[model samples]
Target: MSAIPVTIGRRAALSLDSTPVPAGSPLVDTHGRVHRDLRISLTDRCSLRCTYCMPEQGNEWLAKTSILTLDEIELIARVAAADGITTFRLTGGEPLLRTDIVEIVRRLAAIEGPDGRPVEIAMTTNGIRLPEVLPGLAAAGLGRLNISIDTLRRDRFHELTRRDRLEDVLEGIAAAAASGLRPLKLNAVAMRDVNDDELVDLVEFAIAHDAQMRFIEQMPLDAGHTWDRSRMVTQDEILGALAQRWELTPVPGRGGAPAARWTLDGGPHTVGVIASVTAPFCGDCDRLRLTADGQLRNCLFSTTEYDLLPILRGTSGEWEQDIDGMLRACVRGKLPGHAINDPSFLQPARGMNAIGG
Candidate 1:
């Protein structure tokens, strides 16, 4: 509420001036993968320079000219809505960093749903700037939020994230709970020796606030290619640790949730673990991600991407139809699962931030 956070950008780029994809182009692609859920990155700039994603003060941010405008995002959402996507989420280097984020929420929320209701809207934030946007966003059609808070320790938090906002995020979590953001989930990327010890502490932290916590397996999503299996906190170790610390039991939840559901001994809140590495859920993968720059990534683990901006800007708008055709082409290689741990595997060139992580 003090003031909006500064969105990272040198200046407005020409990339935001592109035309929208036309209608009747069949937004649906081959594998029957209708545009069910769309993850839109507001910007590819994050405040936290995590060891996995960004090196300490050593990274290149995307130029302002290369990012999409709110209008561009609205147009894309509308077209994707026409195709079939009913759910939408705002992501970013940190979506909250984008000062115009609240307006973006309102714009995307205005997108008409299949049943004529506003689209189901949500955001994935780092919680640093959530306090500022929480009120405006909730009023704009945001249904829920997923905040990334990897560690509970203030010192370790600074060490891992290279940011100075542990208490700030904690306050945001409290504010989020009071704001009626039901099913608020804390996303924790489990890393051995970094924050793995906080797994139980995180669950306890969430329970006290009546919030759910999800421990996600660290995958190869960073830029430096520093992902190591030895450093990974596997699903087995997570469950084993929980079993030792608490009387854990399985709890039922959504089908497509990346987390393997579980509950504490006798707590009011639920804690989940997203076994992306030890247990990949590509079989039920029913989502798609569209980058802010107009590239379509069919699978997060796949390096292949289809550039859609060129097609969208062509004179006849024939690119509209090509968007559909391109999607169909992507299905041919939707990759049932990711081989991130394989020694022969190579991570996608783009960092997690670039890919709407």
Candidate 2:
């Protein structure tokens, strides 16, 4: 990909000078899930207040000053890539809400991958604001996109998002696909009595538009801490629903990826479902999240996080040593499952935005 003179205000480019990982430490987790993917949270700021993810009373966001600087985030990504992470994702409280995202993507593309190739950079957005920034992002080395579209009905979209712009979102998807973004991924959360009936239609839309649709099982996260199991729609139910129209079959894989792959009978296109709640994929979970506040989370449901910014701002040698040490230290403490399914479990202190969901 060619470099573009992309500029985003409020942040600056970071230089990567960290040495390669020592011989002993490997990036793969116990479940054979290598640290090939890194999701970095730029800020805990978003434009919408969804009921499932955001509180009705609104969330207490981290102060802007406390969030990781762009350079600091880039340093972490460099270290992470050394440990085998190549597929990097920029997330948010809506990453687009950040003041310097385009520049951030440009800087990330400069971070070399394990094999000296430019890493595959992507983002997950709500897509309402995508049209305005799609060209900038594509030119800045972003190759893939996953947009969250929970409902097709305008009123229902507002109910799910607590905002309006279904039209904007659709247009953004159209623009992204038309821009050669390649088989755009649509993220739809399957909520009982909410968008369940829209599953068939969602599949139709994906097929018609030549996009891959992924239905996510609503998990107990964010404002959904008090999750209504009655409101939950399991992957089994989703499969049953989709099976009505097409003869769905499994697409086997190494299983490190979260979504279980499936193809429609006699069709080339495929769809996926993330059974995070009913069928937890924690055992094979390979991903890790870096919060804007500089905490390294081993698991989404894991309560404790090891902070790394202080070391980064410290002496360069010690910072590199400490970051490498922290990466090694995090491996032993990683959790097999988030354990969010436990009714009595108190969620870790961070909100979805804080953790960069």
Candidate 3:
């Protein structure tokens, strides 16, 4: 495959050596936020087609040659780890779709973080194939898991995902629990009149399975760009639904984490809400995403992307330096916020599935 032109701008001219980024050097943006979490998309292919993520068909996937190889991914990750990135979340259209998922996990788990420890590795997957990959992933040093199941009802799941694989997802969840992947999180996109009614049931199911449930406010990241704010189930609405069944007390100390957690009734098992729209957490954002095709995205909603594929595939003697510079440049260029609520906010061309939810 021919090399794609690098899209890095003049701002990336700042050299890593000149900056002298030491271990744990806060990859600070202009907003005074330190970025340490790196979310990597293993592939742009998935097993299910959720209406909010993508259409049922006619989805264009990244080419095999265009996707980053396991080696290339490790190289970038190693650089990120050395530069203070301590947490890595492997996401995808469905990460399990990658044939080298286990090897990918093992490679990442082997990388040493800024503190000289093996960097923490986690994955967010639609639980359809979790049952088959759980043992391999666990053994590969996976630290945590977040499984997406929007609805507990089989029929409802089919309606939302355009697939009748709720049974597979449930089995996968059970398998993950059995494998002792503790602090397991179940993610549900709370859509008004869709799965909003199942909020309480989902949390109860999570508690029974020794997992925490997180309900996410639907953002305008759908493939069709058909997200209507009026139709979205807000954080307050989700809280209201939960309050009807149980008393929720706020859990303190939610730092850069996306979810604002609340313990149910009193103590122990808790529920969370990722209010990306109603209550944006951009001020505390600490994530940077690397697309499956090797594009670096500082903000999930950012209109800008810096291409890393060219440098990765180039025979240019300064691969490491170039990548490090590009990475820093990307972070340095991060916007103060996604600006999703503002009138000037424009939805990105790519949807959630393409962007690696």
Off by over 4 Å in 2: 1-25, 30-33, 341-344
lDDT per residue as tens, model 2, 119-233: 7888888877788888998899888888888888999988878878789889978877788787588889898988999999998887777788999988667644766778889
Candidate 1: list runs displaced more than 4 Å. Answer: 1-35, 266-268, 318-322, 341-343
Could you estimate the TM-score for every candidate?
Answer: 0.87, 0.89, 0.94
Q: Least accurate stretch of 10 residues (summed lDDT) in model 3?
A: 1-10
lDDT for model 2, on a 0 to 1 scale?
0.76
Report how far off residue 194 is in candidate 2 (Å): 1.1
- lDDT per residue for candidate 1 within 1-357, as digits (tens), equals 112122211122111123343333333434444447778887888878877877777677787866877765665676566556678888877889988888988888887854576788888888877777799989987888888888888899899888888888888888888888778988998998899888888888887777888888888888888788889998889888888877777876556666777767776657788887778876666677888787877778888887766655545433334554544455445665677657778888888888886
The per-model lDDT (C-alpha) reads: 0.74, 0.76, 0.87
State how far residue 192 of model 3 sits from its true place (Å).
0.9
Q: Candidate 3 clashing pairs?
A: none
Best by TM-score: 3
- Worst lDDT run of 10 residues, candidate 1, spans 8-17
